[model samples]
Target chain A: MKKTELLFLKEDVDIPYNWAAGRYGSLFLTRLRDEGKFIGNRCPSCGKVYLPPRVVCGPCFTPPEEIVELGDTGTLVSYSVVNYPFIDPETGSRRPIPYTLGYIRLDGCDTYLSHFVDETDPAKLTPGLRVKAVFRPREERTGRLQDVLHFKIVD
Target chain B: MATKVAVVGIGMTENKSRWDLSLPGLYRLAYQRALEDCGLKSEDIDAVAFGHSPEYFEGVNHPEKWCGEAVGALNKPLFRVHTGGTVGGSVAIAAYYLVASGKFEVVLAISGNKLNETSSAQIGLSTVYDPIMGRQFAAGAPSAVAVQASKYYSQYGYNEDHGLMVAVKNRNNALKNPYAQLRIPDYTLEGARNTPMLCHPLRLADMCPTSDAACAMIFAAEHRVEAITDNPAWVLSAVAVNEGINYVDRDWSKPIGLRKAAELAYERAGIKDPRRELDVVEVYDAFSVQELIWYEGLKLCDWGEGGRLMESGATRMEGDIPVNPSGGTLCANSIGASAMFRKAEAALQVMGRAGEHQIPGVRRALGHGWGGGIQFHTIMIFGKDKP
Candidate 1:
């Protein structure tokens, strides 16, 4: 038997992190850091409201007919505490792990929006937990999903 | 009697880490080749059926919109179908329906994947599993296949040598394929055995290459087939079958979707014994173990006999039933395009157009694709003479 040297090389490559922009199904989430205003898209065909509006209604296959104002209060449908740091597109760096990401079913919307949760305790999180949207400060507000700081446990 | 649909022309772009061309540029190259092969212009195409895997693979959503003009689908009836890796073959199946219905005289089926455009296709594929059940266990495609391989070996008492032999044979065959991406000059079973393991029971060489390429095929009704080419590869049967996504319920060691899809295709193609009736086979082998599993799923061999089939050299190019004469997805996998390439390669073999990898006297060829956690499966049967 002969021995062969086997080595794996990791290449550093510059890649486009924002290639999803300008696409037809591009999702737009308004930064709601300071205010509690809720936004959603309404499908004219089915009259169903979709939170974190989709370009086309999954059932109807039609573009959203109108924009609807949703309630900031919603029920937490599902959640997970990410134990590993994930690459952040905005920073091009790894974000701290153990952060709470949850699906919030806003009032009047048929679907849920995936966002960060403020409460870090995994034990405290449960399905159907009432939460309210917390917005970023007005000065730091940007027109992105991150503008909605996180979802906080509503007292 | 329903009119038969046959493949009139086929074309494919070079498979590699394509950085020289953009997404649309890739489609134009294959589309042009297909049109020229059929001796027709874009205007002659009645409709377009396109398939690409996850939109995330290209970092573009609604890729059909971007690829419309390049594939000559601009302002034409264009439909996009995605079933993960099987999407390419599914697209051809969709095109066949259009021609078989006697509504469309000619349909152009195109598929492509730009793995280079995505920062990490592995990450994209990893996200496809259930967020909770499989995501944590996901070590990407290699690890999943390795898990299946481990189970198969444990159950069947097969050794790692079988996989090494497959890698060596496929890579060797790739030398004859001009479109193959990973061409090794002195590839051998010994070289494969020494390669580092990406996951247990699965070495790096056992996995398919992440190439960026496009493949297109023109489908026409029986009335229009003779006008396009004298040697049309008639489509005998096409079938797509889906199974539950949960890997826990099904046997990962064996693919049920593939078996079901193959059974349905065999029934429609009037095939009694695939080993005797089918002359060539192009299966979806993203991993070496998958080809072995597919050998049984396709019924080329009995259950628990896939390893023996390989050991007996029954699947070689000169074997009783030639499998993967095109080097399969192992040599070049442009995910979306690979499935279409299987169908195209099988058709080419039947048409006697496959220059180097052609199996002598190939009359009936089977093409298959599987994707989405192995939940989606597509099978197509092509023959030199009309069914």
Candidate 2:
């Protein structure tokens, strides 16, 4: 009789990546992280406003020229009150239920921005409800959408 | 019969890691250059055809939508086309068709990718293989092509020197191209052969570098061609062919799709003998061995004699039919845009606009794009005189 042992070989590979925010994305994100200020870019040719600024306006095919400060308060056009537990794709774990998501039309901006809302009750969430951005503290803020922790119903 | 069309403008950004510009911004730079080169405004472009590498490389899905305005396709019609390494070639063919069909008088075609955006483009390359049957063998592009080289060379009883000679020749030629990223000054055959081997037959020097680059070319109808440029590279013929990857009787050593495409392009262009008639050529040589393999596929030489052709120096700068006068994809490869540069460089040669890399007495030229596990092949022929 003969005895044999099975062996296994394992190796790990690491891949790192860096993403550029581009010219306009950096400006909006920088103002959010540095000053807790909301900003949007205005198209030079069409006067259209873009939040989380892009290099150019799609409809006009022209570069955005102006960076204007925007009010933190906005009207909630729509919202969803999620009551079921689900996996958070960004964290790879179960996310807490009863979270609220909303599309808010910010003041002086032509486009709508999506963000998390503090309210989870569908009864309290309504169209045209005024919401104000609540930002993270400067010490904890990174130049990303998460810098603004969430939006709270102000009216 | 389709109307005659010609290349009126060509724009290519420098090949390297461009960390500063966003993907859309990078695309804008190429389109802007093309517009300036042809003395045309955004309004002049009737439509836009765009292309880039897989979304897995940059994680930007629907890149054409994101870059529509960047290439001046705001209100104008625009569409995205992709075929892996031959994406640019497909876009070029689309533009030619758009103009030659009389649907558009002027068409703008832009293709490329920010390949450096990903940590490992090889990771994206690995996904192209069949998941159930072949994914376990998916190590990256170089590994697959190394086996391809091994199989082809084994069939011919030749060693790795032929591939190394191509690497050395392209590196020396890259010195003349300003947009080349890996230009090694006075690179020699000894230098190529001595480089560390990555796979069995492939070395570090044999493969192309990942780059963040874009290329744009404008195709104009014959009626509108003179208004755009005094010199235009007339489109003699263009063909694209693809084979199913079932591998029923597949042999990568002999690319059947490329052979068919080349045969059709030559037939349409009235070229009887390619090696003697064509003045110059730009074939997508993503790896050194591909240059030799494509030589056979392009009918520059017969099968099993590709190695012998390399030994004869018939594909060199001083050869009868000079290949890769702009250093080809071996010098600069941005995946999506790499193949278009071949077509653009060939057009540049015909238009006498290839700068220092231009081969002398180039009246007829050919551009080839090979891609997608050797399944997709595209051939475009260029001539100085209108057909």
Best by lDDT: 2
Q: How well is candidate 2 docked (DockQ)?
A: 0.01
**How far off is each candidate at the interface, as Cα RMSD in Å?**
11.9, 23.5
**Residue-wise C-alpha lDDT for candidate 1, range B1-387, written one tens digit per residue:** 667999998989999976667788899999999999989999999999998888767777898888899999977899898888988999999999999998899999999989877666776776675442234334446545655676576567786787777887788888888999988999988889888655546677888988999999999999888878999999999999886543222356677778888899999999999999999999988887778889999999887889899989989888998888888899999999999999999999999889898888989999998887677889999998888
- Clashing pairs for predicted structure model 2, backbone only: none
lDDT tens string, model 2, B1-387?
798999999888999988767889889999999889889998999999999878877877899989999999989989789899999999999999999999999999999898877766876786676432233233457656765676676667777788888888888888999999988887888888888765556677888988889999999999999988899999999999995442322455788888889999999999999998899999999999889889998999999888788789888888887888778899898998998999999999998889998898889999999788767888899999999
Clashing pairs in 1: A33-A135, A33-A136
CA lDDT of each prediction against the hidden true structure: 0.79, 0.82
lDDT at B382, model 2: 96
Off by over 4 Å in 1: A1-155
- The DockQ figures for the candidates are 0.03, 0.01
